[model samples]
Target: MSEKTGTFLVTHADEGSAVFRDVSDGQVHTMASNPDVAEQDVLEATIRPQPPMEVAWEVVEVAERREIELVDTDLSPTTQAMEIAAEQEVGDVERVERAGEGEVHVLSVPPETTEDAAADVLDDEGTIERAARLGAVRVEVRREEDDGVLNVRYLPD
Candidate 1:
């Protein structure tokens, strides 16, 4: 069988098996065995259908693997992000694509919970999954010190 090569994100992994999602496309691949990969990991790999059934895939070669870095910055949200936050209600989120690559996410939360919300975003696996989908290498989280606004910037290398 022919092999497919692309960037993939490890969407789920456990002791027995793992699931990968193509970054460029939304195709899903399931592997029968754990490939020493963890959830939220980004990988450049070649995969081929398993023999017989061909319902599952196997990683033939892995060219690269990486983890998205999450950073907590003391910097406040950008002017554009602040403006978007102002127009949103508490508990709302807005996503804006960057001019080049990646994305900027504006979140509005309670002023008293801004820090907690920021921390939650930084710790969420979905944040890394989003970065992988956007081909981003890092995520920078910025929060307003006294306001109810936060900016999560997914940056490309």
Candidate 2:
């Protein structure tokens, strides 16, 4: 598969509609105009300006397990994270290391047979119950890895 993956940019303003000249060869797309949207909805963004403005983006991408990198991932490896989360029998996430600018929350997941526990943890809605639910039979509940080390579960099926 191509190293390039599709991205879903969700922002008040369609900031990704345009890109810098150097990076514009790819990774650029047209924006859909929305008139119903209030000025505040799209503050001073790449698209439009608001009365008082501030803009930001939330980009998302989906990739297969083989396409994922262990340490450099934007999100946790749900498969592994969940397995680790479930095994510890605890629910508390702590930042293990800084991933890019965002930190990595080494959540513990049950040792069930879910494909990607780590990814689930990273995509979590910041709710333990929700994260846990994603874990097939096992939940991606964050637990401690002894001392102050926060990790995922390690329970066996």
Candidate 3:
């Protein structure tokens, strides 16, 4: 009987149903019917628990919905990001905010594990969640071939 309104990230979508994770609180809501939203979409909506079990939720109204684009580029990390990576040990991740908006995340990893690390970041739901929280529209992943440093930039456009 209660409704919640906030930004949500679509984590899963199939033929008939979809799963959304609340951007603010990380609560998982399973919708009985797909709301025409796809995975990785950020939605601003009001939702109420379904009848009977109330274990599921339904989207009563959608104020806004957008897909956050992901781009993987061959570009190298920024000079500042490289400097931060140089100062940190392997397996360290540093988050730096942009002057205008969004954030740049610098990750230091072993050269042998660089590819795996980048792949992991690209595949993580947390990445999209962070972008949604920051109101970013796109995520760019940059890394040098065989390098130990990677950069994930959340950008608004």
Candidate 4:
């Protein structure tokens, strides 16, 4: 989908949505905006056109949005690793910390845990799948395949 940004002049509100006039060309558009918007208040929003999930083309995310701004900041590598590791770790993940290059996360599980056992545990917990879908961190549950050892390597995203 593509994004469209504009100023909205609210005209009416109903059922958690709003009818607004796009100030750019005086065209009327209905979107899900703030219900409390005054009749003439102008609102900045980011809208994406969704191609007919069940109906015709529609716009969404019209409540509150602002122009994009870029900022510069430096965050600790360990902190970043920990956050991603935590998000991906299931109940068996005993420890998560930053490691050296090539593999950024070091995870410690129970002494008795094997790679297959860890994989089974993670499967039951379902957090690893979620982490994979989120794509926030790259990780592996085993260090060496032949050794049958369970470990986690965080691949930075």
Q: What ranges in model 3 sit over 4 Å off?
A: 145-147
- Give the residue spans of candidate 4 off by over 4 A: 32-38, 53-157
Cα lDDT of model 2 by residue, 113-140, tens digit = 2225545553442322222222211233
After best superposition, candidate 1 residue 147: deviation in angstroms? 1.2
Ranking by TM-score: 3, 1, 4, 2
User: Which of 2 and 3 is the better model by lDDT?
Assistant: 3
> How many residue pairs clash per model?
0, 41, 0, 1
TM-score of each: 0.80, 0.27, 0.91, 0.30
The 0-to-1 C-alpha lDDT of every candidate, in the order given, reads 0.91, 0.30, 0.89, 0.44
TM-score of 2: 0.27
Q: 1-157, model 1: which lDDT tens digit per residue?
A: 6799998989899998899998777789998787999988899899998999998888999998999999999999999999898899988999999999999999999999999998999988678878987889999999995778999999997
State residue 144's C-alpha deviation in candidate 2, in Å: 14
Q: Where does candidate 2 have its weakest 10-residue lDDT segment?
A: 64-73
Number of the top-ranking candidate, with TM-score as the measure: 3
When summed lDDT is taken over every stretch of 10 residues in candidate 1, the lowest stretch is: 124-133
Kindly give the stretch of ten consecutive residues in candidate 4 with the minimal lDDT sum: 66-75
lDDT value, residue 87 of candidate 1: 90
On the 0 to 100 scale, the lDDT of residue 53 in model 4 is 49
